[model samples]
Target: MTLTKQHLVNTFEGARNNNSPYVFVGIEAEGIKEVISIPSVSFDAKEQFYNNAYSNKLVHVMNSKVKIIGLTHGYPEALTDLV
Candidate 1:
């Protein structure tokens, strides 16, 4: 199964709040995807995806103390260039 925008948002939100830097991402089987923490990098949900998939959810995300840059789909190295 393909990961939906909502799934990515939820995963990002959870990882963001806990100050996590990385999280494993997969489809269909929840157990297949492991949540891993990545190093912290300055990120903003509104600025990144305001006009994209997160526009409607911007207000809720703004309340989060931690910054969310992007959702992880693979190993930590794959996310290094994203930050």
Candidate 2:
């Protein structure tokens, strides 16, 4: 099933609250839709990539329009699930 941005935000928030590892992976909304991954911890960086702004740092740089396609707890799971 195709996931929405709200789903991504919700998953991110839930993981944060539970203190569990999370890695959000998705592709660009347009063009070739290159795959990219964003670790939950990155949100806590000084850049504040996870700011309330819809056009946050990760989206602005990694993908103009990121469509979260998969979520996993840590790299091992990401590798197994996303692959």
Candidate 3:
């Protein structure tokens, strides 16, 4: 599902509160539609990662406006369908 900023914030908070590992995959809201990964973590860290415009472990997009399209919990089973 597409997520707005507030939705993103809430999702991040929920993940953190539950101490669950989640990996979100999104595309740019505008041109190029670059793909990116939003790893579950603190809001500050997510903001930092967004601002930095880079993902060492995943694809990077400059000034990315992430629109989450999918997510998976951190576990082999959770990734089976995705893979």
Model 1: per-residue lDDT, tens digit, 11-54?
56666777665554321122232333433453343324532523
Which 10 consecutive residues of model 2 have the lowest summed lDDT?
Answer: 46-55
Tens digits of per-residue lDDT for model 3 on 4-80? 44444555566577666664444546444433444554446875654355443223454334334433444334544
Q: Pick the candidate with the highest TM-score.
A: 2
Report, for every candidate in turn, its global Cα lDDT versus the true structure: 0.43, 0.51, 0.48
Candidate 2 Cα misplacement greater than 4 A, ranges: 28-35, 44-66
Tell me how far the alpha carbon of residue 68 in candidate 1 is from the true structure, in angstroms, after superposition: 16
The best candidate in terms of lDDT: 2
All candidates in order of TM-score, best leading: 2, 3, 1
Off by over 4 Å in 1: 23-39, 45-47, 50-83
